[model samples]
Target: MPSSVCIMEDPPVDRLTSPILKKYYPCPNASPGYFSLRHKFRSLFQLPRIHASELPVQQNKPVSPADALTAAAESLQKKVVQNKSLISEVEIQQFLSSETGSDRLKRMYTKDVDGFQSPELWFIGQSLLKICGMTFLITSYIGGKHGGEKFAKENQATAFRTQFQASRLRNDHVVLAGMKSGFIWTYRVGIFSSIFLFLSQSIAVYRNKSSVMEYVIASGVTGSLLKANLGPKGMMSGGVFGSLMGLVGGTLIYGFMLMTNETQEQRHYWNIQKYLEVQRELNKGGD
Candidate 1:
């Protein structure tokens, strides 16, 4: 048998009909050179080539602290101005003119105005101070009377009645005992007066009216209750005396307010007006 001759041939050109295959495999008849598959695909996809110069370049500039702060402040100010513009002058005027129940209460109490203490605390403190002064004066007068002999005698009598151990009652002991009595009286008076004033003020706030009548009613009720341990006659006497005192005090206060022309509503109005004016000035400056 004759040996068979080996035969070699190139792959068929028809096999490279696909663009991808044609890109990878060049025809045998073509010249020997590099054919970039990348460019070929780029052209096929219609992608444009970009140069470095055509790209956007950002330069890093150094900013000073002051400039940064000023920029931030300007932006904040602009935001504030925009917010303020949303509130019209007519709305502000309406808000200024209108008074709600809470506003009236705050005005009556003067809670947030002009460094004034709260009404409850102020009245209670005043009552405490008044009681303390009265107690000091009365105790001093009693202790000094008859060279404190009378007070010493009274202390002895009290100790004897109470069956307390006997100590030779001295002038100092008498003074101390008198002070104790004064303290008790002060506590009672201070508590009662504070309660009376608080009730009167609260009633006035509730009714949205400040007048003498509320004080009179509060004092009468408080006085009667304070003396309830006694008989009806004591209550009646206390109520009458309290009412008279209330009338005098209330009249004096009302007269003072009238003379000074310093009412809560008027003060609040002025404060609001000033605030509105300041805001208007700020808006004008912003504009």
Candidate 2:
């Protein structure tokens, strides 16, 4: 009877509240908090925070055509007004000094043009010379001789307005040609100098030959290049090539006209003649 009473009082038989049986225990290794956050996020009506670094970098907005044109027009007007103001001042002075109407107008235009030319000319001249020098050097180095002179002659700055043109500069061909010229000219000068020394027996010819050629080529080419407003490399190609060509042509003419004295039989005779001539000259000086 006591056993039956214990069985009737057993803890209300609720499955959720019942003590866990060791045989049917749940897995402890499974994720516990993973689903909780996801569930809570789904239930909430808020957005997730994103880092600032996750956003793309922004670039500056480009200037519109209207804006650019407006800016240029405004800048030009400013310059024009400045010039006109100066002309007005000059005109007032001229009129006050008893100048005629046409004379005053002439003076104003002249003053403005002159004013613009003076400063701008100085700026353009410096830039032209620099570009020309570079063109000359580079061209001569690459194109041998022709490259240097062509630039030296053609691209010269005849007017200040030419600077604005992009076409008036060294091209790739001139530069490549200039490099070729440098190698060839150096070799030509060396061989020619040796020949000059042998013929004239002049130490000065052999020693200063390279400098002489460079100077000769550099002068006409460099100065003409200044006028041409050409690139340095192109100028170099022209000058070196031109001068060397002249030298080669001159050599060919001289070669055909000269008599050949090179013979085994005459070799000793020529040597003795030279030796005796030297001895006689020495003896005359009391050697």
Candidate 3:
């Protein structure tokens, strides 16, 4: 009789099908060589292997259109509320505080000043002062000229003719007549010019826009009106001259503002540099 042999064999473990390995490495048919290389890498890095059960499951629930819109609206409302909160009582108080007289005067020349009864009044006052002063100086100079003196004397004679004593007028009277003529001219030009300019600028400000065109239009209109007593040729010439002057003045002002802004930026940069230097010195001393 032949002897019978008994054999026992253990089943191979399917590591790729395990919950932990399957969660991390999804490929079930991966080669044993690849697994060995991964194991070597993990060992070299000394990385801890995390189990699938240790991770929390994250479910991506579908969002509805209405829900998305509601969320967006809520976010927008929150942002508006946050922005509103940024402007505080202290800021309002500071903005409303009284300004110095000199500061108010300065702003009158460039921008509308606060604490005034009316912005229009402020603009009117500024225009009056500037235009009147310029006109006074110009008319006085012109009146001192030879032709201007003769013209004034003629006017004085005409006036005194009603008294029947034209030749008997004093030197002081002639001088007074000349001054009177200058005053009349100054008033005519200055008052009308100021009114036109103020109206033009106010319109621009109201429209939330200001440009060289505003000045040009104002000056042209004022010049045309002033020369209306003369022929159309005079009116045209006056308008052209005024427009040219306005253009030159506006360009100069814009250039000046640009230079001022550049200077201010440079000053701010220097101030920051100085502050940084001081901070560094203090830190070094502390160390």
Listed per model in order, the count of residue pairs whose N, CA or C atoms clash below 3 Å is 0, 44, 0
lDDT by residue (tens digit), candidate 3, 1-287: 11222111111245644576544555545655666666666568675889999999999999999999999999988986764324344543443344343443343345322234334355567878888877877776565554445755567535554444543444455566557767988888776767566756554443333456766777777777778789899899888887787788756754674667633234323433443445555665678
Encode model 2's per-residue lDDT on 77-182: one tens digit a residue.
8997654322334443443446343442243233231244222233334555554455556548556456646765775754445544524444554666766765
Predicted candidate 3: what Cα RMSD to the true structure? 24.8
Worst 10 residues of 1 by lDDT: 1-10
Collision count of model 3: 0
Off by over 4 Å in 1: 1-120, 140-147, 151-169, 231-233, 264-287
Best by lDDT: 1
User: Which candidate achieves the best TM-score against the true structure?
Assistant: 1
The reply for model 2, stretches above 4 Å from the true place, is 1-164, 171-176, 179-181, 184-259, 264-268, 284-287
Query: Which rank order by lDDT, best down to worst?
Result: 1, 3, 2
Candidate 3 least-lDDT 10 residues? 1-10
lDDT of candidate model 1 versus the reference: 0.64
Question: 1 or 2, which is superior by lDDT?
Answer: 1
Candidates sorted by TM-score, best first: 1, 3, 2
Q: How close is candidate 3 to the true structure, as a TM-score?
A: 0.39
